[model samples]
Target: MVDSIRQYLSWYGFLFSLGLALVWVLMRIAAIARADVSRYFVDRLMLWISIGVVFGGRLGYVVLYEPEEFLAHPVRILSLDAGGMSFHGGLIGASLAVFLLGRASGYSLWALADIASSSAPIGLLCGRIGNFMNGEMYGPPTTLPWGVVFPSPGPERRHPTQLYEMLTEGVLLLVLLYPLNFSSWSRRHLGSLFGLFLIFYALVRIAIEPLRADNWNYQLAGVAVTAGQIYSLPMIAVGLVILGRSLSAARLRDRV
Candidate 1:
């Protein structure tokens, strides 16, 4: 089984399957909740989102982590797999894609956001697993029994922060949001689920900041900051604003 799997398995293949599954599952959930997204529009949305994530993630990584390298060879941005991709970048790209898709397709923006947000955990789960397999996002050295000695990083036992994120942002988030997808309240609340997604994701990421931040920590002046925390802070504020506005709107509608 291991030999056969090795022959056929590639990171790209796994990613493609996961991306397709994420979109398909999202459409199904939206249908279950009766979102206004059409089958035709979704097909286009998926295509655009795939392109956006790949391009944006790569660009984000270069811009944020390796500006010098980018300045040295601007054309290197064209290489999707030249190095690690950034989630923050992918998020920006996906958001733009969703906005464009929603506008062009005449679908409800919040509805698309809600569906996309909920289904994102599926992709996160896959992405985190990919990170683990690639030996890129492991945490600091650990004495814990479950820590893995990644081939690329070293022989030191490090926390599997990638798996930690999979559990927190992927599994737990899915469980939390699954119920909302079926609710009459959720449908009316519009951006509520999306808002909650951003909030929950930020919270979870911050929680794991210490773990994943080991390799990617940044220091400025005299302070240390994790890249995840930096990106997540603004998102938390954005989530709060969204939730606040959504609740206020819901309240007004209730009075009507």
Candidate 2:
């Protein structure tokens, strides 16, 4: 048991917790560093949301797909350093925290969502790179020149899908959202840019997942399609709904 535990921790620990910690610290610093909405209250709210994200993400991952693994070693669930987390779970957690915090702060949820969305990609990029370093979430086998040879489970040339996601969902997402700053869409609808960010990233993620390596975590329409894809569907749907609603509202406001 000791050797098994040691091996598991050695293989899957460090990067997991460190990635989250770094992101969390950066987010808080960014919030405080910014003059736009810097306030004690805002900082407090962000703290609460961060707590929610960490807790919710861990619990959600276990509940959603790895109940047995977590249940067998209940303590390990809290050991994020041992890895095994779901981005979808973290998103849900963050969203829930944002909603609750927004309400408590007497702020529009959409506006807060927009702010959260704006700075999110940078943090995501960091996390994905961490994922790559940890050799956790990698892509399927590939003969491409850019394919990376992840050193875990089995050594083979695989798509560095996580990095692809980091660029698209993180860096590219930020670039796409930047236009909102000058466009009337952002000022008018507030969350319109954020909505587009979500939709765009989810769409890109759907495409990226196919290239990812097949693992036990992958699952599909009651079958198996990869956990990454399965988790992205709802985000795509929600983003679409938000985008559609925001557009209609903008149109109505313009007519008025």
Candidate 3:
């Protein structure tokens, strides 16, 4: 069943693009329900976010993962056909777009961020599933019963880290955040959901880093730490700061 699905996905390049489309739809729905924003605003926001995700994800992958190669062939930066994207980069780009749009539209930045964050897990889920279908992002060898034998890495059974992320970062996150998005308290606190999203995603990525095989070259000073883990540390810290500030502001408002 899994192989058949993978073959189907391979036959047509739909899963990743489908994921983006779903994300856009989810965001638009969220904007209407949560913010009651106009159609024009939603359309504009989606456009900016799409641009951010593509350019930012590509640039991030180039700079962080393969700077030397990209520098040697700079034109390859525009060639997304080669397939490299960084989630962290996309998050940064999307956040920037949200911030900019919020400023221009006179909407609350935190509120817009909350809406995006709430819908982000859907994208993560789809992207990880796409990775699984493509047989990429498999983890190190494992003797576990459920371990999968991916095509590129040759016969040894490996932990399906993409599926792991699909569960933790995608399914779990969506379950956790989606309800909070509709909660009165979360709405009042504004960026609380976004803060939690960051903290949870970073923690999960850090936890899953040890299982992944591709980050060996990015290990830190002979330690087992991968670049993803290193990048995630800041996310955790920032999440904590944002969560704290949002809660504090909410409390202050309540007291007034």
Candidate 4:
């Protein structure tokens, strides 16, 4: 059944879904930002973010995961058709784009970040589903009833880590952020939402790293650690800093 579904699933449909996800999230972010800035501000920001996601995701994959291979073949950097992307890299790229837009437009960087972070999960959800359809990013062999036998990794049944990501990072994050996005407290304390997003996503990524068969493993302070966990550690720290500042600013406002 799984093989049949994978075979019949349209690649075009997957691409379309990704495109659709981008459009939907961009529109939603733009709508939220419209109240604060000009109608075109969000549009321009989204364009930069799109560029960032492509370049940053690609470059990140090269720098972080496959530096040796990409270094050997510099020409392959442009070959995005080969399929390699890193979400951490994409986040960094998007954050840089947001910072650039903020500087150019004289807008609040934190506000823009909150808007982008709120809608990011939709794109993630679609991307994970695409991973599943391609039978990539599956976990180690499993005996569970729901274990999937992917085509590329032989006949052994494996955990559907892609679906797990979809549920946690995509759906769960969306649900958590949706209410916060609309809350008055979040509006007053800009950056809190974005901070929470970073924290939550980093934690989830770390939690699931052990399940991913392809993750690079290492020893950190005698603890078994994956590359994903190492990359995510900084996000937690940054999130805490941002969240602390937001709350501190809010408290100061109350005293005034």
Candidate 5:
């Protein structure tokens, strides 16, 4: 019993799931509490968007990475109970929800995106912690002292890459988004925050793919990649285009 308990602790069990649930609840609470005046805060919108993200993310995982198995059992694709969701798909789904909501409510798409971006890190940080608990995306062989001996089927010590991502894409992004609200940067160019968030996230995710444990993407021209990186490239490109347009608009506004 003691050994089982110790293994559970080291493996990161229910504690991780609890952390995600806690953050999600807190975000809902925050939306409810701030709904009085903040255009960005809406309980229904948040709930719907969350649903879209989870559903889309799961579908994307099967469609992009494991289509063969899913093809064999089409019904299993919808069974998220087994656990598989792609971050890129979730982003796309959430963005679609936001777009629809924004158009209906007369809110700017990027402005809504900015509001969502601020809250993104919370989910990301929690999700990575959950990943650490699951021991699914462990890193390649490493001689570093901090290397983890995962109770996973492998005997090799690997880098805690998930934690690394949590720090950069989650914690650091949150810090960056805070001061951005007070700055005039976005005011001059609406969507600057959103664009930057997407671009930065894509760059960071792509940079970390090399350290990933598995090469889950198709190889193109002798370059091995992962599904995560492939999905991220479009985000970076779109962000760059948005950034350029924002700058041009700002310049035109100044001229006018």
Candidate 6:
């Protein structure tokens, strides 16, 4: 059973399926929650989101992680089997997709964002596991009892950063989303869940970057920091702005 499962879900195939599955789940949840929303509109939005994530992730990976290789062979960017994707890039793409779709469909932008954010942790959780299974993105050596010795990084025990991401970015993310998911007030208060997800996920990514030895590093103002952490800082600031505005608006609505 295990061998059969492994054979079917190779890296390229897994990523393709993951994006589609998450979109399906997100649209289904939204449909169930607001039965009045047109299912056909949801389907159109899903197509955009899926395309955004795939292309965005791929291009971002090329630009951020492998600019030289991409420049040398520009056509290589289309090679999905080579395996490179960026989470931040995909987020950017997906957000843009939603914004455009919302504008066309006459749906609330933040409301769509909130619905997607509430459920995206499931994809993050699964993605981290995919990383672990592929024996990629392991962390530096650690003496902790729970450290794993992945086949790629030699026999030394290392922090399983993938699992850490799964725990912090995935399970804990779901926990934070739980209240927003069930509360009627939260649903009506557009952007609350959307901002919360960005803030929480950004914080988790920044915290975890330090533990990841394989992360891309660059020097900034005589200080060395991982690229992941650098990218997350902007997300944190943006999230704070969105969250503050959303809260203020909700308060104003309540008063009225």
What would the per-residue lDDT of candidate 2 be over residues 61-95, giving only the tens digit for each residue?
88876788878998876566555566677777888
lDDT of 2: 0.69
| Model 4 misplaced regions, further than 4 Å | 1-30, 81-83
Off by over 4 Å in 5: 1-41, 78-83
Taking the tens digit of each residue's C-alpha lDDT, what string does model 4 give over 1-256? 3444444346524753585467456546545644654546777878888888867877888898889887898876666544468888988898899899888888788878887887788788888887788787899999999999999899999999999999999899888885675567777898888999999999999999899998889999999999889999999999999999999999999999
Model 5 alpha-carbon miss at residue 59, Å: 1.0
Model 3 residue 249 CA deviation in Å: 0.5
Q: Write the per-residue lDDT of candidate 3 for residues 2-93, one digit (tens) a residue.
A: 45444645722476677778877877877666754564677788788888887888788888777988889887766654445888889889
lDDT tens digits, residue span 1-256, model 5: 4554445445344443453455455444433443321434455567667777777788878877788898898877655433457888888888888788777876566766665665677677877886787776779989899999787747878999989989988888877763565556755677777788899899999999778785576786798888788889999899899878888999999999
TM-score of each: 0.88, 0.79, 0.90, 0.89, 0.83, 0.88
Candidate No. with top TM-score: 3
Considering TM-score, which of the candidate structures 3 and 4 is the better prediction for this target? 3
lDDT of 1 by residue, 1-256 (tens): 3443343246744864685577666766565566556666667777787788877887889987778987998876655455557888888988898998788777788888887788778788888887777676788889999999998767899999989998988899988985787778777788888899999999998888878734467785677878778888889999999888888998999999
Q: Of the candidates shown, which would achieve the greatest lDDT relative to the real structure?
A: 3
The lDDT values for all models are: 0.78, 0.69, 0.82, 0.81, 0.72, 0.79
Error of 3 at 90 (Å): 0.9
Question: Per-residue lDDT for 58-153 in model 6, tens only?
Answer: 888888788998799887666654445799999999999999888887778887787777777877787888778777788999999999999867
Model 6: how far is 43 from its true place, Å?
3.0
Better of 2 and 6 by TM-score: 6
Error of 1 at 204 (Å): 1.3
